[model samples]
Target: MAWSDLLAGFAFFLMIEGLLPFVRPDAWRRGISILSEMQDGQLRRTGFIIVVAGLALLYLVRA
Candidate 1:
């Protein structure tokens, strides 16, 4: 609820987002390449699913 809590959450998110590239740059590059090759609709659906999953997790954690 506080600004500090929001900043801390973002910091954790950044650390987690960096892990794959830090640990396995090649794999991360390959994944990005595959993502780039996806069709627009496929990419949209994949993004929507990811958003929904993240929202569901946030709801569960906050609730």
Candidate 2:
């Protein structure tokens, strides 16, 4: 993949990640609080699932 493609993807990620806090700051704070209360094991599992889901989506789109 090209550097431009990588940069574009990172920019899109930033835009998406910024949306929730921009649109609903209270909800975003609540979500962060909940995440902070999670146990390490639970957080790790959740992160793993998210990563796998993203990879699967990328594979489907690219393939």
Candidate 3:
């Protein structure tokens, strides 16, 4: 992909990452607190799942 494509993707990612906190700060805070209480292995597994899902989506979208 081009540099502009990469930048645009990053911008969209930032916008999405901000949505929950902007729309419902309380719920976002609660979610963050819940994540903070999770065990390391659980968090790692969650992260791995998210990464794999993202990659799968990107592959499907770009294919």
C-alpha lDDT of residue 24 in model 1: 100
lDDT of 2 by residue, 1-63 (tens): 899999999999999999999999999999999999999999999999999999999999999
Sort the predicted structures by TM-score, highest score first: 2, 3, 1
Q: Candidate 3 residues 4-53, lDDT tens each?
A: 99999999999999999999999999999999999999999999999999
Off by over 4 Å in 2: none
Better of 1 and 2 by lDDT: 2
What local lDDT score does residue 29 receive in model 1, on the 0 to 100 scale?
Answer: 100
Cα TM-score of candidate 2: 0.98
- The runs of at least 3 residues in candidate 3 whose Cα sits more than 4 Å from the true structure, single-residue gaps closed, are none
For model 2 the local lDDT of residue 60 reads 100
